[model samples]
Target: MLLGYLLEIVKDRDKAEEHLVSIFETIPQHIDRITGDGVNTWCELQRLARTYLAGTMYADTTSEAKFPNTANKFSALMNDEQHAVFCSIYYYGKTTAQLAQELGKTEDLIRKALREAFAIIRKAS
Candidate 1:
């Protein structure tokens, strides 16, 4: 359960390590606080802490780095179709087929848009 939650929260390995450190350091104190309350409190504390850590990690990781200037350059170069496709895939988490249907295009066209968008972004980087 913890591993699955971590995977959702941490996009990369380095961020996962940082979050793990933060969680481990605080967990002992959290455990001690609920010790005398019995099994129910202990279990509740554990579950709460786990969920809290996942949210904390995601916020910290994403909020630290603003989009770079290169990202702006890449965005400026992208046409409307490319922008929509990229946003649907990354921000909205849509599958290629879903994006295609929403955009009234074929799946292959959506895939091409995604490929072109990434190529531009990669070049900018």
Candidate 2:
């Protein structure tokens, strides 16, 4: 499932496989942190995988690149900022800090945008 998720993000099986390898390489460190009450294993693993891929992900993006094929009605419902923030973290595997820096916003604002984006998704669903 993780590999499928990554493959959806990267649109490249080899890159997705590499990221999967890298994520699994460091999973031991995250396992304890994710093993708490109410923890969602799939969500936690996705977050961890995103973090590991964040640095490498943006390196592959071009300014003219279109929105990913994975974009759905949920994403279409977002405002531009919300879409950018959400897609960057949710698909491109960016951290809030990275998005904050890239967008010239504070971390709080980036987080807020992410929250708003999720809210939109939840509401639309």
TM-score of every model versus the real structure: 0.44, 0.71
Identify the runs in model 2 with alpha carbons over 4 angstroms from their true place. 55-67
lDDT top scorer = 2
lDDT of 2 by residue, 30-66 (tens): 8887776899988899888777766774445424254
lDDT of 2 at 19: 83
Specify the highest-TM-score model's number. Answer: 2
lDDT tens digits by residue: candidate 1, 69-108: 2224666788878877765454334578776777789999
In model 1, the runs with Cα more than 4 Å from the true position are: 1-71
- In Å, residue 60's CA in model 2 sits off its true spot by 5.4
Query: Residue 106's C-alpha lDDT in candidate 1?
Result: 97
